[model samples]
Target: MSINELTKKLKNEAYSSLYLLYGKEKYILEYSQKLIVQAVLDEGSADFNLSSYDMEEQPIEAAIEDAETLPFMGDHRVVIIQNPYFLTGAKVKQKVEHDLKKLEQYLQNPSEQAIVIFIAPYEKLDERKKIVKALKKQGEVIQAEKMNVQLQKEWINHASKEANVKMTDEAVERLIELQGENLGLLIGEVNKMALYVGEGGVIEPSIVDELISRSLESNVFTMVEHVANRRIDAALRICYDLLKQNEESIKLMALLARQFRIILQVKQLKAQGFTEKKMASILSLHPYAVKIASRQSRAFSEEELKDLLIRAADADFEMKTGQRDKQLSLELFMTGIHKAKQTN
Candidate 1:
């Protein structure tokens, strides 16, 4: 089932007998698990009804047996089976023997009075297995994956609505620019901003600029933009700010190199008639990031980008070899690039 379907079901107190929550997105996976528990049992009854087992150390039959049993004092029993590695194609040495037959039998006839949840934190499951096919047929499978740009914007809007505040489109865009696509951090920042704005208040771009902390990578991206625009003073100011925050010069240089590399790649790919989505897939980057890089790539020719990369490598070598002061080497690299742009 989709997350929205699960949310609607939980809203109406409609509980499912079997749930297979598997994903790489830890925040969504854990949050969904909590929501299920909250919907299945009250605070007082949770102590008696909720049971968790680790399949890594314990047998699957133990969890299946618990699921077969009735609740102690509640209407339903909730059994959480964690780290079911056998369901995947991984070759992990078993610490304990699991009765797959028992699990298969339980899936064929799950207890009506129990809610069994399988939490498999994996990218892909072994679909070839009969047990996996049976579970898919019998349970509600929720795949938690990373959200794309549009989905992320929708999530921000939903979060704002939940907080009883309104977020403008510009504000949402700025939040993504500052926070990147980490959903957990984005939600936390959204809640904090909501509290500041209070109920019935609108969140604007100015508020986002004032309240949200800029990540190092975001700062580096901004610095590169300043360089591209020939605003050397603004770029130097950002470098100083990061230095004041005790950011190592070597780390900053590495990020700078990475940013330049991305811009060059985006430029080359765009020249080849590649779409933004296709470029993101090839580069293993978010589409939004690719979009930004594509725009930035216009400010410099391919030759300039190649030169900057070489300079960055030379600066790195000098710093690591103790041939120059690390901070001085970074400053020189930036200023030298600025001068080269002006001369050209």
Candidate 2:
């Protein structure tokens, strides 16, 4: 099952006897766990019924025992078992031993009075294991993998609605730009923005611009945008600001080169009939990022991109060889871009 499906079940108060939640996305896994805990356990009796164990430090039998034991002063219990390394094909780093027979027995007759949640922070599980097979057959499984950008946007809209805050589509895109595609960080940013905007308030792009800290990667893109548009003054100003913050010119050059390289790749791929989704997967980039780069790449020809990359590489060589001052080389490179833009 996906996170969305699991969430629907939790909202409907559909509690399962055993849940096998595993994924590479930490946020999704943790969020699913929270939903399950909230749906099944009351706040007052949570302390007595809630139990967590690290499988790396303790044997699996201990958790099984906790799951089988009756709820304390409550009608049901929630047992959280973390880092079930036995489920994976990897070797365990710790000396702790797990009882496979005990776990297999517990899976066959899981307590009707308890909810056992096995949290595996792994990309894939050993599907061939009998224990894993039994759990899959007997328990509800939730794969908390990363959602695509469209799905993430849907979630953002849904989250804003739940927070009772109105958010425009532009605001949603801006939030994703500021925070990137990490759902966890984006969710936190949305929550903060919602609080600032208050109930029934609309979160605008301007509000996001004011609240979020622009990452260095974002700044580099902004600088490159200025260069692409022949806005030399703005580009130089951004460079100076970064220098004041102790950003090395060589490092900035490297970032600029990388950005241009990506744009070049995006342009070539687009020419080859690649969609943004396909480009993102091929380049291991966020779809939103690929979309932005695709638009930006259209502003320049392949020859122009290659020329800019060559300039960046030459500047790097000059800086390293001590033939030119690092800062001066960067400033000169910016000036060269301006001159090239005029000639075009």
Candidate 3:
């Protein structure tokens, strides 16, 4: 099932017997695990119902033995197998194939007082193995992996809507700016903002400014927009602000390089019979952002974009180890972008 499906199932009291959460992203899994723990145990006695099994040293049977036990005061036990290195190797599963065969039986007929939670990084799972296939079929598995910045925005907006608050456009943008691609961190920030604003919530930019410290994302995007508009002075000011915020010159060069790469992709896709929506899907970008980026790509020719990327790489190298002045190297990058804009 998808992550949203798992989340809805948890909310609807539709508890699965086994919850196997493996992913590039752990935040969603952790959120669902907490929901399970809360559903099975009261706030006061949650500690009693929650228990962990370490699989790095213990065999799979240790977890089975633990699952056989009952909850102390509640009707269910929240059993978590953490960092299970055993699930990764083929030989280990081969040696314990019979031992794991019983787990399917248990899943089919789980004890009334038990809920098993399995967590491992997705790359660690041996997908070809029998036990792996069986476990996938036996329970609801969630892949809670890392998403891009635009996905992070959707998550923030959805999370806000779930909490019964309307996030202003600027507010949502500010949240993305402060916390990039970390829903867990965004959740924390949202909680604080909700409490800080209280009822009749108005999540304005000022409120965001008061709550979240400005981050490198705002600086990065502002620099990009400034360059796009041919505001070299404003771009230089933002670069100084980045330097004042202790951002390394090489880091700025790297950010510029990444932006140029995206612009190149935008230009290429626009030429290759791709619509903006198709470009968004292919690049995993927000529709609005794809539109803006496509327009921005019109401001530079492909050859000019290529030269800018090369200049960015040279600036990165010079800023990192060359004997030239660091600020001067970054200034040269800004001027190059300006030159490229003029030529286009």
- Name the candidate that leads on lDDT: 1
- Clashing pairs for predicted structure model 1, backbone only: none
TM-score of 1: 0.94
lDDT preference between candidates 2 and 3, better one: 2
In model 1, the number of clashes is 0
Residue-level lDDT of model 3, residues 257-321, one tens digit each, is: 88778889989999999998899889987554566567778778899888888888777778778
Model 2, residue 73: distance off in Å is 1.7
Where model 3 places Cα greater than 4 Å from the true spot, the runs are: 1-14, 85-105, 123-128, 145-154, 168-180, 204-218, 281-292, 339-344
In the predicted model 2, the residue pairs found to clash are none
lDDT leaderboard ranking: 1, 2, 3
User: What's the CA error at residue 43 for candidate 1, in Å?
Assistant: 0.9
lDDT of each: 0.92, 0.89, 0.75
Across 220-336, the per-residue lDDT of candidate 1 in tens digits comes to 989998998999999999999999999999999999999999999999999999999999999999886888899889989999999999999999999999999999999999999
TM per candidate = 0.94, 0.89, 0.80
Reference-based lDDT, residue 311, model 2: 94
**lDDT comparing candidate 1 with the true structure:** 0.92
Candidates, ranked, TM-score? 1, 2, 3
The segments of candidate 1 whose C-alpha lies over 4 angstroms from its true place after superposition are none
